[model samples]
Target: MQTSTGNKPFSCEVCGSAFSQNSSLKRHMQIHTGEKPYSCEICVSTFSQKAHLKSHMRTHTQEKLYSCEMCGSSFSDNSSLKRHIRTHTGEKSYSCEICGAAFSQTVNLKSHVRTHTGEKPYACEMCASAFSEYSTLKSHMRTHTGDKPYSCEFCGSTFALNVTLKLHLRTHTGEKPYTCEVCALSFSHIFSLKSHMRTHTGEKPYSCKICQSTFSLNCNLKTHMFTHSGEKPYSCEVCGLSFSRKSAVKRHMFTHTGDKPFSCKVCGSAFSLNRNLKSHIRTHTGEKPYSCEVCSTSFSENSSLKRHIRTHTGEKPYSCDICGSTFSQTAHLKSHIQTHSRIGIKC
Candidate 1:
């Protein structure tokens, strides 16, 4: 089907693909030939199309001409500015018919559609784990390779992607735009605000197939499954120590590096993570919010509440990586290793 008259009508002889202009047809031919005529001056990168090469040049230039009216922040392109404008407008034009959920962008709508359709088209060749989108599959592949391309300009903190780098930039900027309607609790990112809203709505969308237990997010559901499956995917190459979560592995790296960033404001005691500092704060405040529903027994920390619940459920989820031994707590499993291990044994 042809539209109105155009200058040059170029039709593909092989695939029947037609283009309005001859130049577009010539550019399209490079895809089949695998030819990259455009090359980057700064790096060894090459592109088949000239437009992609122009966009790549913006990275070297650091030139963001497009500015936001609301936030006064600049972007490299017009599309990025348009996406930033949606944050101010709160206008979700693209919506899902199945769930009646709306999103700002068409790409995000397509990703959300996979949740309803259960269509995971992209799969990992090594593990056969599926992903809804090609970009997510690319990020998942980086886990296998341990590739961190995005690095901070200030402290040299490395990230897997540009979005993660942007989120990390917020810690330096102190810009929290996403605010809650209920509590007025602000977050640096819109995704963080959406996750915080789940606490108010009591919405647990992600559920386990085995126990039917629910979670607020897909990542939480993934972490919860590790308890049942005993899957420790992230492992230390130095000592062969395994962990269920990636963040746990990152914190454990502090032991090797001797890095303790978290410090108490009340006292001079230092800790590895913010959660440890939070648990330490309970000693001063004497606050025990997590209480047992059955016996009304209170605990200083939520981990204690979880351990106490295991007494009722008889769930010893944590298992040894070396042997087949299981225990309720990870600390207990660590202590149990001494029975089988010789003196001066690492990990």
Candidate 2:
């Protein structure tokens, strides 16, 4: 009756949130103090309120009290059941003010707002890392703990996160839900689709602070950062040679195995890398896609075009360590180094 009459006499001292009962006010105070008195014996999960602990206990008991009539899905709580029903109705009441992105849950809307505000409330205790979402922080903790709780039923493969396990399951199912509107190409992951979209849009959002070099993918930008840091994390087991990127390490392994998997359909020529095969194909088709801006000269390869541009710009990027002599190309630098070797000088 007090809740309906807008009479909440018991007010919180910290947040000024009013409650009808004094017991409810005491539970609400735990939020400000970061206190969780109630804990689950099964999972060691803590909750501020006893009702929350009771709700969590249903997970261990497998006692679902609420059921969705639309899909017959059962939930431990009525709030969870209501959230699940939104999936069928496609109803999103909560919305972001900045981007106008809608979410069914208020918690999701709060999480989305962090993207605009750049707020990271949940911080890692082990490492110097922070996350906007508490769930993301929990996932980050697994990296330090080396925990792989989520496992695949098909392949028996383990993953640190449930979303990663879902992505892995798509490999076995061959389910490509994310589709491109421009090319009709499909991807299993949303991130893969977003990266593929850059190919059509010509967008290079990821940029290196050191060289100002831009990349379409964050992974490519991370690999570019290795050049600045001189960090080679990926190492080949056969040759013991290190590379900045994992793909580069894989390509290096092919040299040791003498495995040329990528073969040209035109001339029966084989290459270790698919990009090399694509460049080799241009030679047969007489396709010179790379063009010079100044002389209008065309080249089959981008590297060749870059070298050609150096001729016009008088830019000698490759420099000799011994004599400090600069050359337009690596081949020119190698030829210059040979001169030093012939003259009894070590380079």
Per-model lDDT: 0.89, 0.92
Flag clash pairs in model 1: none
Q: Which stretches of candidate 1 lie over 4 Å from their true place?
A: 1-174, 290-347
Q: In candidate 1, residue 150 scores what lDDT?
A: 94
TM-score list, all predictions: 0.42, 0.58
lDDT string for model 1 (119-163, tens) is: 999999988999999998999898899999999997899999889
Give me the overall lDDT of model 1: 0.89
Q: Which model scores highest in TM-score?
A: 2
lDDT of 2 by residue, 1-347 (tens): 12343678778767678898988888888998999999999899999999999999998999999999977889999899999999999999999999999999999999989999999999999887999999999999999999999999998999999999999999999999999999999999999999999999999999998889999998889988988899999999987888998988888888898999999998899999999999999989999999999999999999999999998999999999998999999999999998998898764
Lowest-sum lDDT 10-residue window in model 2: 1-10
Best by lDDT: 2
Going through the candidates in the order shown, the clash numbers are: 0, 0
- Predicted candidate 2: what Cα RMSD to the true structure? 8.2
